[model samples]
Target: MTLDGLPERGSWKGLRAENGKCQFLSWKNDFKPDGRFTITFFRDAQQTQPIQTEHGTWSAANGKNELRTDGVRMPDVYTYKLTDVDTVRYVSLASDPSGDCQEDYDFIERRIRG
Candidate 1:
Protein backbone atom coordinates (compact mmCIF):
# COMPACT_ATOMS: atom_id res chain seq x y z
CA MET A 1 0.00 0.00 0.00
CA THR A 2 0.96 3.65 -0.41
CA LEU A 3 2.58 5.54 2.46
CA ASP A 4 -0.69 7.31 3.10
CA GLY A 5 -2.31 3.93 3.60
CA LEU A 6 -0.24 3.17 6.71
CA PRO A 7 -1.08 3.68 10.37
CA GLU A 8 0.07 6.44 12.73
CA ARG A 9 2.21 5.92 15.84
CA GLY A 10 0.41 5.40 19.19
CA SER A 11 -2.83 4.76 17.40
CA TRP A 12 -2.11 1.06 17.64
CA LYS A 13 -2.85 -0.91 20.74
CA GLY A 14 -1.13 -4.24 20.13
CA LEU A 15 -0.96 -7.39 18.01
CA ARG A 16 -2.93 -10.54 18.76
CA ALA A 17 -2.28 -13.76 16.96
CA GLU A 18 -4.64 -16.64 16.29
CA ASN A 19 -2.69 -18.66 18.82
CA GLY A 20 -3.79 -16.32 21.61
CA LYS A 21 -0.55 -14.34 21.66
CA CYS A 22 -0.85 -10.65 22.45
CA GLN A 23 1.96 -8.21 21.67
CA PHE A 24 2.19 -4.63 22.82
CA LEU A 25 3.41 -1.85 20.48
CA SER A 26 4.19 1.61 21.76
CA TRP A 27 6.30 4.66 20.81
CA LYS A 28 7.35 7.81 22.62
CA ASN A 29 9.45 10.99 22.06
CA ASP A 30 7.74 11.52 18.72
CA PHE A 31 9.98 8.86 17.25
CA LYS A 32 13.21 10.39 18.54
CA PRO A 33 14.99 11.14 21.78
CA ASP A 34 13.75 7.89 23.20
CA GLY A 35 15.46 4.84 24.66
CA ARG A 36 14.55 1.34 23.49
CA PHE A 37 11.08 2.41 22.50
CA THR A 38 9.86 -0.80 20.98
CA ILE A 39 6.82 -2.21 19.22
CA THR A 40 6.73 -5.80 20.39
CA PHE A 41 4.40 -8.78 20.55
CA PHE A 42 4.41 -12.27 22.00
CA ARG A 43 5.07 -15.51 20.21
CA ASP A 44 2.36 -17.11 22.30
CA ALA A 45 0.44 -16.84 25.51
CA GLN A 46 3.28 -18.59 27.28
CA GLN A 47 5.39 -15.48 26.98
CA THR A 48 5.14 -13.31 30.08
CA GLN A 49 6.65 -10.29 28.40
CA PRO A 50 6.92 -8.74 24.96
CA ILE A 51 9.57 -10.01 22.59
CA GLN A 52 12.72 -7.96 21.91
CA THR A 53 15.08 -7.69 18.96
CA GLU A 54 17.66 -5.32 17.51
CA HIS A 55 15.32 -3.85 14.89
CA GLY A 56 12.40 -3.31 17.23
CA THR A 57 12.63 0.15 18.72
CA TRP A 58 10.97 3.55 18.88
CA SER A 59 12.56 5.61 16.11
CA ALA A 60 11.34 7.66 13.16
CA ALA A 61 13.85 5.94 10.89
CA ASN A 62 11.87 2.71 11.32
CA GLY A 63 8.67 3.29 9.43
CA LYS A 64 6.32 5.90 7.88
CA ASN A 65 4.86 7.68 10.89
CA GLU A 66 3.85 4.67 13.00
CA LEU A 67 6.17 2.12 14.61
CA ARG A 68 6.25 -1.31 12.98
CA THR A 69 7.39 -4.66 14.33
CA ASP A 70 9.57 -6.88 12.14
CA GLY A 71 7.86 -9.04 9.54
CA VAL A 72 10.26 -10.95 7.25
CA ARG A 73 13.77 -10.53 8.61
CA MET A 74 15.76 -13.20 10.42
CA PRO A 75 15.12 -11.59 13.78
CA ASP A 76 12.47 -9.33 12.21
CA VAL A 77 11.90 -5.60 12.71
CA TYR A 78 8.59 -3.82 13.13
CA THR A 79 7.96 -0.37 11.72
CA TYR A 80 5.02 1.94 11.12
CA LYS A 81 3.23 3.42 8.12
CA LEU A 82 0.48 6.03 7.62
CA THR A 83 -2.00 4.35 5.35
CA ASP A 84 -4.63 5.93 7.56
CA VAL A 85 -4.29 7.77 10.82
CA ASP A 86 -6.95 5.65 12.48
CA THR A 87 -5.74 2.34 11.13
CA VAL A 88 -2.28 1.00 12.01
CA ARG A 89 -0.66 -2.09 10.59
CA TYR A 90 2.12 -4.20 12.16
CA VAL A 91 4.53 -5.81 9.71
CA SER A 92 6.87 -8.58 10.88
CA LEU A 93 9.95 -9.89 9.05
CA ALA A 94 10.17 -13.27 10.86
CA SER A 95 12.44 -15.89 9.37
CA ASP A 96 13.66 -19.50 9.75
CA PRO A 97 16.84 -21.19 8.59
CA SER A 98 15.33 -24.38 7.27
CA GLY A 99 12.17 -22.56 6.23
CA ASP A 100 10.37 -25.20 8.25
CA CYS A 101 10.48 -23.10 11.40
CA GLN A 102 8.89 -20.20 9.56
CA GLU A 103 7.15 -17.96 12.04
CA ASP A 104 6.05 -14.59 10.70
CA TYR A 105 3.31 -12.12 11.58
CA ASP A 106 1.46 -9.11 10.11
CA PHE A 107 -1.46 -7.35 11.69
CA ILE A 108 -3.33 -4.07 12.12
CA GLU A 109 -3.75 -1.90 15.18
CA ARG A 110 -7.10 -1.78 16.89
CA ARG A 111 -8.13 0.75 19.49
CA ILE A 112 -9.34 -0.82 22.70
CA ARG A 113 -10.83 2.29 24.27
CA GLY A 114 -12.07 4.34 21.31
Candidate 2:
Protein backbone atom coordinates (compact mmCIF):
# COMPACT_ATOMS: atom_id res chain seq x y z
CA MET A 1 0.00 0.00 0.00
CA THR A 2 2.98 2.32 -0.42
CA LEU A 3 1.98 5.56 -2.03
CA ASP A 4 4.15 8.17 -3.69
CA GLY A 5 2.10 11.36 -3.77
CA LEU A 6 0.50 13.98 -1.62
CA PRO A 7 -2.06 12.81 0.86
CA GLU A 8 -5.66 13.07 -0.13
CA ARG A 9 -7.31 16.39 0.69
CA GLY A 10 -9.70 15.83 3.58
CA SER A 11 -9.83 14.89 7.20
CA TRP A 12 -7.85 12.14 8.86
CA LYS A 13 -8.45 10.83 12.35
CA GLY A 14 -6.48 8.72 14.77
CA LEU A 15 -6.71 7.77 18.42
CA ARG A 16 -3.68 7.86 20.65
CA ALA A 17 -2.55 9.02 24.05
CA GLU A 18 -1.90 12.74 23.91
CA ASN A 19 1.84 13.37 23.84
CA GLY A 20 2.01 9.59 24.13
CA LYS A 21 1.22 9.91 27.80
CA CYS A 22 -1.93 11.81 28.58
CA GLN A 23 -5.52 10.57 28.69
CA PHE A 24 -6.52 12.70 25.73
CA LEU A 25 -7.61 10.33 23.05
CA SER A 26 -7.90 11.59 19.54
CA TRP A 27 -6.04 13.61 16.94
CA LYS A 28 -7.71 14.80 13.79
CA ASN A 29 -5.80 16.36 10.94
CA ASP A 30 -7.29 18.16 8.00
CA PHE A 31 -5.12 18.63 4.97
CA LYS A 32 -5.95 20.79 2.01
CA PRO A 33 -4.46 20.38 -1.42
CA ASP A 34 -3.31 23.97 -1.30
CA GLY A 35 -0.81 23.14 1.49
CA ARG A 36 -2.87 24.36 4.39
CA PHE A 37 -3.40 22.04 7.36
CA THR A 38 -5.19 22.02 10.65
CA ILE A 39 -4.92 19.67 13.60
CA THR A 40 -7.56 19.21 16.24
CA PHE A 41 -6.86 17.51 19.52
CA PHE A 42 -9.64 15.86 21.41
CA ARG A 43 -9.91 14.40 24.86
CA ASP A 44 -12.32 11.73 23.75
CA ALA A 45 -12.22 9.11 21.08
CA GLN A 46 -15.49 10.35 19.71
CA GLN A 47 -13.88 13.73 19.06
CA THR A 48 -16.51 15.61 20.99
CA GLN A 49 -14.14 17.10 23.53
CA PRO A 50 -11.77 19.16 21.53
CA ILE A 51 -8.98 20.57 23.66
CA GLN A 52 -6.86 22.42 21.15
CA THR A 53 -6.49 23.18 17.51
CA GLU A 54 -3.42 24.23 15.53
CA HIS A 55 -3.03 25.64 12.07
CA GLY A 56 -0.07 25.41 9.75
CA THR A 57 1.22 24.85 6.29
CA TRP A 58 2.32 21.49 5.03
CA SER A 59 4.45 20.11 2.25
CA ALA A 60 5.66 16.79 0.97
CA ALA A 61 9.20 16.14 -0.08
CA ASN A 62 11.74 13.39 -0.55
CA GLY A 63 9.70 11.89 -3.32
CA LYS A 64 6.54 12.51 -1.36
CA ASN A 65 7.62 10.17 1.41
CA GLU A 66 8.20 12.97 3.85
CA LEU A 67 5.69 15.41 5.25
CA ARG A 68 6.67 18.72 6.82
CA THR A 69 4.39 20.94 8.84
CA ASP A 70 5.30 24.56 9.62
CA GLY A 71 3.43 26.11 12.49
CA VAL A 72 3.86 28.78 15.16
CA ARG A 73 6.33 26.60 16.97
CA MET A 74 8.87 24.65 14.99
CA PRO A 75 8.52 22.84 11.71
CA ASP A 76 7.80 19.19 12.33
CA VAL A 77 8.93 16.61 9.85
CA TYR A 78 7.75 13.07 9.41
CA THR A 79 8.51 10.16 7.20
CA TYR A 80 5.32 8.46 6.19
CA LYS A 81 4.32 5.15 4.81
CA LEU A 82 0.91 4.24 3.50
CA THR A 83 -0.73 1.24 5.09
CA ASP A 84 -3.63 1.37 2.69
CA VAL A 85 -5.31 3.76 0.37
CA ASP A 86 -7.18 5.29 3.25
CA THR A 87 -4.63 4.86 6.00
CA VAL A 88 -1.11 6.10 6.67
CA ARG A 89 1.58 5.74 9.30
CA TYR A 90 3.84 8.67 10.14
CA VAL A 91 7.07 8.53 12.09
CA SER A 92 8.27 11.77 13.53
CA LEU A 93 11.72 12.77 12.50
CA ALA A 94 12.22 15.32 15.24
CA SER A 95 13.03 14.18 18.73
CA ASP A 96 11.52 15.85 21.75
CA PRO A 97 14.14 16.56 24.40
CA SER A 98 11.50 17.45 26.94
CA GLY A 99 10.67 13.75 27.20
CA ASP A 100 7.17 14.13 25.76
CA CYS A 101 7.45 10.70 24.19
CA GLN A 102 5.84 11.90 20.97
CA GLU A 103 8.78 10.70 18.94
CA ASP A 104 8.65 7.35 20.62
CA TYR A 105 5.34 6.58 19.01
CA ASP A 106 4.12 6.17 15.49
CA PHE A 107 0.91 7.78 14.31
CA ILE A 108 -1.57 5.82 12.27
CA GLU A 109 -4.22 7.96 10.65
CA ARG A 110 -7.24 6.87 8.67
CA ARG A 111 -8.94 9.11 6.20
CA ILE A 112 -12.33 10.37 7.25
CA ARG A 113 -14.94 10.15 4.60
CA GLY A 114 -18.36 11.65 4.29
Candidate 3:
Protein backbone atom coordinates (compact mmCIF):
# COMPACT_ATOMS: atom_id res chain seq x y z
CA MET A 1 0.00 0.00 0.00
CA THR A 2 1.15 3.53 -0.70
CA LEU A 3 0.10 7.07 -0.08
CA ASP A 4 1.30 9.39 -2.84
CA GLY A 5 3.89 6.72 -3.61
CA LEU A 6 5.07 6.33 -0.03
CA PRO A 7 5.40 2.74 1.12
CA GLU A 8 2.84 1.63 3.64
CA ARG A 9 5.40 0.48 6.15
CA GLY A 10 8.57 2.46 6.80
CA SER A 11 10.10 4.01 9.85
CA TRP A 12 10.44 7.71 9.13
CA LYS A 13 12.77 9.62 11.42
CA GLY A 14 12.38 13.35 11.68
CA LEU A 15 15.48 15.29 10.71
CA ARG A 16 16.96 18.61 11.65
CA ALA A 17 18.76 20.57 8.92
CA GLU A 18 21.94 18.92 10.14
CA ASN A 19 20.24 15.54 9.59
CA GLY A 20 19.75 14.58 13.17
CA LYS A 21 16.81 12.57 14.46
CA CYS A 22 14.79 14.88 16.69
CA GLN A 23 11.45 13.22 16.12
CA PHE A 24 9.90 10.28 14.24
CA LEU A 25 6.90 8.59 12.62
CA SER A 26 6.47 4.94 11.78
CA TRP A 27 3.52 3.67 9.79
CA LYS A 28 2.06 0.21 9.43
CA ASN A 29 -0.69 -1.21 7.27
CA ASP A 30 -2.20 -4.65 7.15
CA PHE A 31 -1.97 -4.76 3.39
CA LYS A 32 -5.60 -3.97 2.96
CA PRO A 33 -7.24 -1.35 0.78
CA ASP A 34 -9.22 0.10 3.61
CA GLY A 35 -6.74 3.00 3.66
CA ARG A 36 -6.25 2.26 7.32
CA PHE A 37 -2.90 3.03 9.03
CA THR A 38 -1.13 3.00 12.34
CA ILE A 39 1.30 5.79 13.25
CA THR A 40 3.91 5.85 16.00
CA PHE A 41 5.75 8.95 17.17
CA PHE A 42 9.09 9.59 18.77
CA ARG A 43 9.49 13.21 19.86
CA ASP A 44 12.91 12.83 21.41
CA ALA A 45 16.17 12.74 19.47
CA GLN A 46 17.63 10.06 21.68
CA GLN A 47 14.46 8.00 21.16
CA THR A 48 14.30 7.26 24.86
CA GLN A 49 10.69 8.31 25.30
CA PRO A 50 7.59 9.12 23.34
CA ILE A 51 5.69 12.39 23.56
CA GLN A 52 2.97 10.97 21.30
CA THR A 53 2.01 7.34 20.95
CA GLU A 54 0.51 5.37 18.08
CA HIS A 55 -3.18 5.47 17.25
CA GLY A 56 -4.40 6.78 13.92
CA THR A 57 -5.42 6.28 10.33
CA TRP A 58 -3.52 8.25 7.66
CA SER A 59 -4.67 9.01 4.17
CA ALA A 60 -4.36 11.61 1.46
CA ALA A 61 -6.18 14.86 1.99
CA ASN A 62 -8.78 15.21 -0.76
CA GLY A 63 -7.74 17.74 -3.40
CA LYS A 64 -5.17 19.27 -1.05
CA ASN A 65 -2.20 17.14 -2.11
CA GLU A 66 -1.33 16.53 1.50
CA LEU A 67 -1.27 13.62 3.95
CA ARG A 68 -3.74 13.60 6.75
CA THR A 69 -3.55 11.46 9.87
CA ASP A 70 -6.75 10.96 11.71
CA GLY A 71 -6.80 10.40 15.52
CA VAL A 72 -3.41 12.00 16.25
CA ARG A 73 -2.34 15.12 18.03
CA MET A 74 -1.24 18.54 16.67
CA PRO A 75 0.25 17.51 13.33
CA ASP A 76 -2.73 15.67 11.96
CA VAL A 77 -1.92 16.98 8.48
CA TYR A 78 1.17 17.40 6.32
CA THR A 79 2.10 18.57 2.86
CA TYR A 80 5.24 16.91 1.57
CA LYS A 81 7.73 16.73 -1.27
CA LEU A 82 10.50 14.17 -1.24
CA THR A 83 13.90 15.77 -1.59
CA ASP A 84 15.66 12.46 -2.07
CA VAL A 85 15.28 8.75 -1.42
CA ASP A 86 15.96 9.32 2.25
CA THR A 87 14.52 12.74 2.92
CA VAL A 88 11.01 14.14 2.79
CA ARG A 89 10.08 17.64 3.85
CA TYR A 90 6.66 17.92 5.47
CA VAL A 91 5.95 21.49 4.43
CA SER A 92 3.78 23.69 6.57
CA LEU A 93 0.24 24.58 5.48
CA ALA A 94 -0.39 27.85 7.20
CA SER A 95 -2.43 30.13 4.96
CA ASP A 96 -0.86 33.35 6.22
CA PRO A 97 2.40 34.86 4.92
CA SER A 98 3.37 35.89 8.43
CA GLY A 99 3.66 32.24 9.41
CA ASP A 100 7.10 30.69 9.70
CA CYS A 101 7.81 27.49 7.76
CA GLN A 102 11.49 26.95 8.47
CA GLU A 103 11.89 27.58 12.17
CA ASP A 104 9.78 24.45 12.70
CA TYR A 105 7.70 22.10 10.63
CA ASP A 106 5.23 19.26 11.01
CA PHE A 107 8.57 17.36 11.09
CA ILE A 108 10.63 16.43 8.03
CA GLU A 109 11.33 12.71 8.17
CA ARG A 110 13.92 10.50 6.53
CA ARG A 111 12.81 7.06 5.43
CA ILE A 112 14.40 4.41 7.62
CA ARG A 113 15.46 1.52 5.46
CA GLY A 114 19.05 0.78 4.74
Instruction: Give the whole-model CA lDDT for all candidates, comma-separated.
Output: 0.41, 0.68, 0.47
Q: Pick the candidate with the highest lDDT.
A: 2
For 18-113, candidate 1 gives per-residue lDDT tens digits of: 553433333211222332334434444444454553233433344633333335334434555545545556665543353222445666665433
| lDDT winner between candidates 1 and 3 | 3
Rank candidates by TM-score, best first.
2, 3, 1
Name model 1 segments beyond 4 Å from true. 1-11, 19-57, 62-76, 94-102, 111-114
In model 3, state the lDDT of residue 90: 68
Q: Show the colliding residue pairs in model 2.
A: none
Candidate 3: regions farther than 4 A off: 15-34, 61-75, 94-106
Worst 10 residues of 2 by lDDT: 63-72
The candidate, 1 or 3, that scores higher on TM-score is 3
**What is candidate 1's TM-score against the reference?**
0.38
lDDT of 2 by residue, 1-114 (tens): 122554757899998655565354688999877777888888788889898887767777663333344433456667787777788888677642432345345678899989
